[model samples]
Target: MLGLFIAQVLNGLLDGTYYLLIALGLSLIFSLGGIINLAHGAFFAIGAYLALLITPYVGYFGALVAVPLIVAGLGMVTERTLFTRFYRIDPLYSLLLTFGIAMVIEQGLRWVFGASPQSYNIPDILRGQVFLGDFIYSRYRIFLIAVAAVAVAGLWLLLNRTSFGRIVRAGVQSPEIVGALGISLRPYLSIVAGIGIGLAGLAGVLLSPIYTIHPAMGAEIITLAFVVVVIGGLGSFWGVIIAAVLVGLTKGVLVAIGLSSWSTAAIFLLMFVVLLLRPRGLLGERILRFE
Candidate 1:
């Protein structure tokens, strides 16, 4: 039982890692651009499809590198062609535009790949089961944990330690102020969009082997990601990371103890409770109108 519990906890953390990557990117872009980015998930699907094309040729490790690059390029294009034009509009316009793009992307994927889930296998070296206390865990899950850790660390450094990160942080607080500083923010905005969608792509590649890779695979996760962002406090990047992992762990604990029904509602309930007591979310402040 002890070993089993440890293994389950590990699984939960591994799961949370993917959630963190996806939510972290989403939160950052939303903060900097004030765009809800509903099409972020479409980038995930694009990554999966890119991985599918390359995995057979370069294998899993190479697929990881190639998929993100391809999807990142696509994300850049999307930002320039679609998202950028909506920048001056209200936040609702951004939200609606992205949501519509997501619908189009999904339909395209369904048309090409059909409605069935596609199967992907982890590399041979990373395959098979490893034993811990006579309980076996898949090596792929362990790989996921490692990959997630590195990705999150890289993102942390990008957003907090680097000059680009400093610029991003400044823009997040106030885009116009950053713009007036004699810096062309359009380039930065495009780069941030690429990073955000690239992370989503990475999540798709990470989850491909574990979950059914279908046209609509991103929908459920997108909903959960939103809950995490809201509960973590929108416009706060690290808060999203912390809250996502906690929610992932909560789901694991709830389901492990036979409260499976609560697993679906767990984060939502937490959000509701948090908002009731703290309207600004866990890390946000209520925006007040000027007198």
Candidate 2:
């Protein structure tokens, strides 16, 4: 039982990475753009589908590098063409617009990819299981964990240690100040949109082999990602990270105890409790008002 518990916990941690990546993007976009993006999941689905189409030509390694770029570019275009116009308008308009886009993308993918789930071939090198102490886990899962950690670490360094990151952080706080300083917030905000959407794409690519790749795959995870964002605090970077791990572990523990069906309910319950206890979220700082 102890070994099983440990194994499940590890599995939960692996699952947390997906939540982290998705929420990271959601949080970043909201922080920088003041636009609540409901179509973020569509970007994820697009990434997975793109990977499916491109992987044969480029192979898994090449697809990994190309898919995010493709999705990020798409996101940038969407921002430039659609989202940017809605920024100073009501947040509801942005939300409704993105929601519509998500539906359109989802239905389009369904028409193209069909209603069924597609199988993603796990690379031969990552197919086996490895023993970690007394518990054995899939090597692919461990690789996913490593990739998520690295991605999160890289993002942290980018936001904390670099000039662009500083601009992002400052812009998140006050775009007016950033503009007054002579830096056009447009490029930085666009980049944030790309990074945010790209992170979702990256998550889609990483989890494709493990989960059933389908047109509605983004819908499956987006709610949980939003829950992570709310529980972690809307624009709080570290808050999202902590909430992702917490929610993932909670679900893992329930599943390990033979309550898999209750996992989602449990997470929602936890979110409710957290909101009641700390409305701003675990690591959320003062909410920023975008001008």
Candidate 3:
């Protein structure tokens, strides 16, 4: 029983990685663009569908590499065509826009692929279990953790270490100052959107094998992803990471205690506690635009 409890805790942590991937992108896009992208999950679904379509020709590894880039390109296009128009306007406009896009993508997928769920097999190379003492875990999940960690670390370095990141951070604080410095945030905005949305695509690819792939899969996950972002605070990168872990831990503990049916409710309860304590989120920093 103790072993099972420990295993459930670990499983919960693994579950957090999925939210981490999706929520990071949600946070980044909102931080930089001021766009509350409701359609981000649709992109995630697209990635999974794209993986299914391409994996046959390029294989799983190939799909993993190619799908994100393709989705990122699509994100860049969306930023240029749709997001750019609403940057200086009311945020609600962008929200509505993204919601419509989400619906379109969902229905488009349904039209093309039907409403049925699709299945993806685990790659042959990653198929197995690893036993650690009395606990056993999926090898693919281990690989998923490693990939998510690397992606997070790389993103951190890019934001904290690079000149591009410096500008983005400054822009987040004060777009007026960035504009005064004669830096057109246009290119940066496009790139950020691509990077953020691309991460969603990557999550879709990595999770497709384990999750049921369907048109509404994106919709199903987006709410939890939003919960993570809200609990973490809107623009705080580290907050999102911590929140994801906490959310996962909360769910894990609930399951371990034999309240598995209440796991989802427990996460919301955890968020309520966090918000009651810290309205701005655990580490949410004040930004000019949001204020």
- Put down candidate 3 lDDT per residue, 57-89, tens digits, no spaces: 999999999999999999999999999999989
Residue 111's C-alpha lDDT in candidate 1?
Answer: 98
Winner of 1 and 2 under lDDT: 2
- Residue 76 CA displacement from its true place in model 3, Å: 0.5
Per-residue C-alpha lDDT of model 2 across residues 1-291, encoded as one tens digit per residue: 888998899878767878899899999999888888889998999999999999999999898889999999999999999989998988999999999999999999999989999989889988999987888888998888888899899999999999999999888888889899999999888999999999989988888998888989888989999999989998898899989999989999999999999999999999999989988888777755842
Lowest lDDT 10-residue stretch of candidate 2: 282-291
The local lDDT score (0 to 100) that residue 95 gets in candidate 3 is 98
TM-score of model 1 (CA atoms) = 0.92
Give per-residue lDDT, candidate 2, residue 114.
98
Q: Which wins on TM-score, candidate 2 or candidate 3? A: 3
lDDT of 3 at 82: 95
Which of 2 and 3 is ahead in lDDT? 3
Task: At residue 95, give the lDDT of candidate 1.
Answer: 90
lDDT of 1 by residue, 183-239 (tens): 778898899889889889988888888777889977767888887887888767667
Each candidate's TM vs. the true structure?
0.92, 0.97, 0.98
The 0-to-1 C-alpha lDDT of every candidate, in the order given, reads 0.80, 0.90, 0.93
TM-score of 3: 0.98
